[model samples]
Target: MTDLKVRKLPWEFDESVPFQWNRENPRFGIMMNAVSFLAPAFERFIVSSTRAAMAQITDPATLEEADAFLRQEAIHGRAHRNHTAALVKQYPGLKQVLVDLDASYDRVLKTEPLEYHLAYIADIEATFTPLFSVMLNHQDKLFDIGDHRVGPLFLWHFVEEIEHRSSAKIVYDAVVPSPWYRLRVIPKVVAHVMGCFSMFCRAVDTHVPAADRGIDACDMIVRPKRLTSLFERSELPGQFEGVPRTEVITMLYRLARAQAPNHSPATEKVPAFASEWFEAYEQGKDVVNWYRPARVAG
Candidate 1:
């Protein structure tokens, strides 16, 4: 069995959690909030896909991993639902955003074959280790400075993502066993995920007031060239403006490498912070309020 622990975080987000949770970097917070919109629906799709794939998985060990992965994802979905529910309570239109997002994934689950769902999950899960490594490695900037209630929710989610990085690919290999097929499906998967993110951003723009979000909610959905132009013009704010070109290049390279046919998440370099976060959790540190000195003190 994989060393995947299904830990419940002490996450309690009530009326006080701001839409701009990351006060230092509202854009980053809003970008991640878009993810909050996506996580519950996408994770449900993951659970459904894994349940269908389980019948065909012959290996007991792989079955165990899939079960653990589903449990972890279910917990993730619940935590994100709590967060999103808080948002929707504040901005009622976000309820429709959730409805629309769920419908989008429901369409996929209904229309796509089990293999396609597996491939879609595998393609997206494959990138998390690398993509989140960049974010976790820069936690001080991206997470630590954010709201104590909100930052650790994402931190916990990302670290667990690193822990289960291999689960989706293992299931996919057991069922489909075709790297070329996985690669072939990447474009569609990317388009689908990006389209969902765009929808979330547009909804944020429509629902949340400008003063509340403190940045263009649609900024994150822009084309790469436009992003680069904004970066060059010094229009980007917070950590985005100071992100090293080399760091961005390295992250892009690692993200591409993650999707390669032979790529093994087992061999990927994990961020040091992931290990530290795990250790902290094991030691009973208050991970839900990770940045607060009193809560984090061991």
Candidate 2:
């Protein structure tokens, strides 16, 4: 788990910071907040699923990694809960959207088999691993565009997400160990993630007034290049687009393959800055000093 550190972050959100914090891009900001709204619950799911599997594993190294993963997730969930609490209070209607997400997660937790839960963890973590890379690679641009205070929370979260990317797969393979089982479960997991993402976007758009709304990217699903840029750059005032359902599914296919018995994800390198940040933390140095973009030679 790369020595996962449970750093106490200063995460405080309020109406003073616009709802669309990312360069005032309404939909982008909403999408980011929507993810935050669902994060605490989703992280709790990860913790429970991983811990349940950890109970059955016998390897000491796996057990240690599992413990560290749980601690990091526990802190992550707390930070997100605090932020989301602030969000729902500002926009009361968002409570309903979060309720819907909670209901969906509850239904799965109560009905699905243990393997399904493990598969879901592996599925989402796989997606996050590469997604984190994209964010880290473009952090300077993203942070510059977004609210500075909120930026560190995301920076901290995604860095740790990359650090523990393999924990779920490690636990999943230990327990399930069947390629056939993964193939069946992976699609279902992809469907769930994408479905929830769509629901969150719609919910945010519905409750947030048009005057406050940024460009809606929902209509641009077919444009892959634009969608790719969404992750790499902040959207300007007039440019709004999103990832297509088919493309998300295709990306999930590749992510799932990386979780296969003998394969590795092509984009597995953790960003150099993120590595340096955590390494500094381990040595009791001020990691905030390393969060800035590396200076380029002119």
Candidate 3:
């Protein structure tokens, strides 16, 4: 029901490659380190809160999916954590960034009630769905990835993000129950804009050498021109194209009210994109990229 079959996922949270990659790849290393640094700050809160909040969910299938989500997110967090630990072994100065960010972000989130957490999730999921889905659909356009391991990892995570994007919003919107909640997402958009800059700058300062410190942290993985293409090409606004995707996605809740058919893998199954497609996403076998840029850091 929840599509939990692991597809070509890397062995459970390997630290060797990412950690070694960090030491070798300065730009990517710092970017990813910042990801781990800020993750415990904002995302740890979300994952832990989401895990707890999910217990109240009654739908057996959804509950299972949330558990899977918890597992997936925890894996991601750990990979990033190990990456940071590798950084700390090299430079003890880096730990302060995580410490400061966690304290500040937690202080902010702690002041808000459950509604704020739910609303933040709703907005984030809404923003993420269309973006990842579109790229998963359009696989051929992949640019030069330079490295073999990290590129496919990027695409795999991207596909899964598309798959689960609606789940959080579906969960949160159930309780928030406001059309205004959709519009309220505008401010939440700031998190990406602001959070990226804050996290990246901090990481660069901590890790980049005094001479090359001028170089941006994520530039190697995220080429500048492509970054622009990602914003314009993803066509996320298309979900709101004729009518809003949110409007249709909201049906996840209505499914309960109307007593819709039960969710089953028989009905909601995945093909084995596990082969070549998942790496760059073959059109047919991979998720039909829902008709979307493609991008990320850390």
Candidate 4:
């Protein structure tokens, strides 16, 4: 992990895993594209969170670690943007959509204050840590998207979510000198989640199907054979290297307990995500089964 120095945003990543946007597979590409718009917004929040709380971060070691955290997020954002561009070549309309989304982030920055922004980051990533676990454990959760490419990208993002679950809070606690931050950030983040969901829903309505562009993360969890249906159609067996959904959620709870103070995920007012995670675990799925590590793949 120490050697995993953070990389900057907008970096190049080759995402040529053979994706197509047909009627049945309508949302895979769109979901990929939709998540793509979040990159710039995500990046700006990280950068601002880091700087906004700079004065509070006293430990040199912690600051250095936070710097690496920022670096990785930057890399993620850049890679996604470039990936979006490559996909744009396939779907020309997305280019304008992507630009508008980036512009929207700028608009958000101007509207919200620093505390509100950091709280939103905490809330979003907090929601992300769990929802991501379901996707990260695609097989166990039984989310059979029936594709090889998107899952890997999503897994990579999920792992990174775990990697930096504590960053925003760390920065906020260090820099922002307000007890209200602890209380305020939660509701503030909840509101942000509402707005963010609306944005995704809007994007989905404009682009893909209801199921494909889900309104809540809970809807995505599958109950065995559900996810595999897609891949079966693609000639790949439904079985894949996914971790246990319960284990994944448990790991997140552990991480949450470690990351969030006072120990209540609900007070954290989590975005509408836990049900999706619980269902994935109810399905007793694990994505590690679908995962082919780079070492083995190579």
Candidate 5:
């Protein structure tokens, strides 16, 4: 059996942390903050979508995993909402965008067919699960780019994502077990998520001042690059400590292709650091400070 459980991590978002939390990489900070901006609403949707499907699942183990998944997502939403509340005070534009997103989710929950919601949740988990593994595997490298609190919050989130990677797939299979249906939904999910990310990035660029833009963190992925001389240099955000730009591009491509009939969450390999982090958790160490510069050796 897969080792899956909802972990109650003690991470408090420092309200005093600046909007340009990634001191070394402002673009990364913007992209991360954009993710934070979206998380509360996105996660709430996930929890609700999962709960809506719960009445159909009868397997005791699957039902237990689904419950844990819902608990984890709820906590995740609360944490991101708290952090985003602090962020909106610095960048008020983000709050409006979040409100709009919340309304959009509400509309979907109220009107969309149940299968569509389950497909979105399942495909998104499959796509993000591997990317979260990359983040964990490369955690040490990312430690230097952000404020002490910032990187760990993301790492903590990614760790739980890894822990419950199979829960959504289990629910998806239970509720909407049609490959053809899933295949149609995967493309829509990828396009929707990428579109949302692009919108968030542009919103940041529009609202934040120039000196703090950092690395145009995610624009390179969304827009085509113009050829430039070596001396001209690229403004793209640097790769997360250990993962390369190529790996990210590859992951995005795989996400786009994840609807293939052969793909299954059961076969996705868990990252080494995820296991290491859980062992530390089991040992009762403070995970919130897992990526502190003092704790990590260069």
Candidate 6:
């Protein structure tokens, strides 16, 4: 059995919340906003795919973990739904973007086999520990300066992802038991995720006003021509100037390692902030307003 806590966080977003929530890095903010667009649909896919695969997961402990994992993912879906609803209220055109994302995942669910879907989820979830570790490690730079509502939402999500780091792999191993197949499907999964992000960025570009968004929604995406130019110049663009070169290189290396068949997320080093957040939550501190004091002296 996995020791995962299904904490229901009270997250509320008001009209005052801005699209450029992270004032220090607008590009990062927009990129993460794209993730917010993707989360609900993607989590829905995860829940459905995992539920379908549960029949093959005969191990009682693994089955219990799967149930807990589904509960956490369901809660995450609800939180992200509230977040995206606020965004849609701000920019009604974003409604179409949500529709498009749902349709894309619906197509995948209808077309892909259960094995492929399980492998896809396993591959993606395997990367989160390392990926979110980097983000949480640098939270002072990336998240602490952002809107409290948005930053804490991502913090809660990422820490819980680390909490159940072994879940998808455990389920996949029980059902499919083919690391080669999981590795073989990585490219397709990466392409689909990037395509969804591309769709989100393009939608934001077309819909969210420039002043509100504060940067080109597509700035972080690696297009063909942009890749060629970067390779030729070996120089970072202005948008990426805020991020240290070493951190980027380290993140890439960790992500690559995460894809290995022998790679185990349990062995990976988690960020200190994750532990701190968990401690704070258990202590009944105000986790939703993470960066701000909950009360001021009179």
Estimate the Cα RMSD of every predicted model relative to the unseen true structure: 2.0, 5.3, 10.3, 9.8, 3.6, 2.6
1-298: candidate 3 lDDT, tens digit per residue: 6765344343232333343232233443344344456554556666866776776678777777667766666665554565456556665666776776767657656776666676665555444444443333433333122123333444555556556655665556445556465455546545543564565565656564644433455442344466443224232222122223454354334322222112221232232333344445434432322222233222
Candidates by lDDT, descending order: 1, 6, 5, 2, 4, 3
Which residue pairs come into collision in candidate 1? none
Residue-level lDDT tens digits of model 4 in 1-298:
2323342222343445333322233434444445666676668667766665665667876687567767778777766776666655544544665666666666667887776666666556666665554444453333344444444445455566665666666655565577356555565555554455456545445553345333333233343457444333333222222344455446556544533544433233232333443344347544233343443486
lDDT, residue 225, candidate 6: 68
lDDT of 1 by residue, 1-298 (tens): 7788888776778877899998677778887897788999999999999999999988999999999999999999999999998988899988998999999999999988998999899889988998888888888778867788888899999999999999999999999967779889888998998899989989999999998888877877867567565335345464453567677778778888988878899898999999999999989887877878855583
Query: Per-residue CA lDDT of candidate 6, range 55-173, in tens?
Result: 77788999999989988998998888888888888898999988899999999999989889988888899888877887888787778778877988999999999998888888888
Q: Estimate each model's TM-score.
A: 0.95, 0.80, 0.59, 0.62, 0.86, 0.93
Q: What C-alpha lDDT, on a 0 to 100 scale, does residue 268 get in candidate 2?
A: 74
lDDT of 2: 0.67
lDDT of 6 at 251: 74
TM-score of 6: 0.93
Task: Please tell me which model should have the higher lDDT, number 3 or number 4.
Answer: 4
Better of 2 and 3 by TM-score: 2
Report the error of model 3 at residue 206, Å: 4.4
Cα lDDT tens digits for candidate 5, 1-298: 4356677766666558777787665545676787787787778999898888988888887788888888999888888887877777777876777787787677778887778888888777777776776666666655445777777778778778877877887888888868678778666666767666766676767766656655553453454353222113345544453466667766666665655645776667778987887798899777777656465775
Q: What is the lDDT of residue 70 in candidate 5?
A: 85
* C-alpha RMSD in Å of predicted model 2 compared with the true structure: 5.3
Better of 1 and 6 by lDDT: 1
Residue pairs with backbone atoms closer than 3 Å in model 6 (clashes): none
- Model 3 TM-score, 2 decimals: 0.59
Q: Note the Cα lDDT for every prediction shown.
A: 0.87, 0.67, 0.48, 0.52, 0.72, 0.83
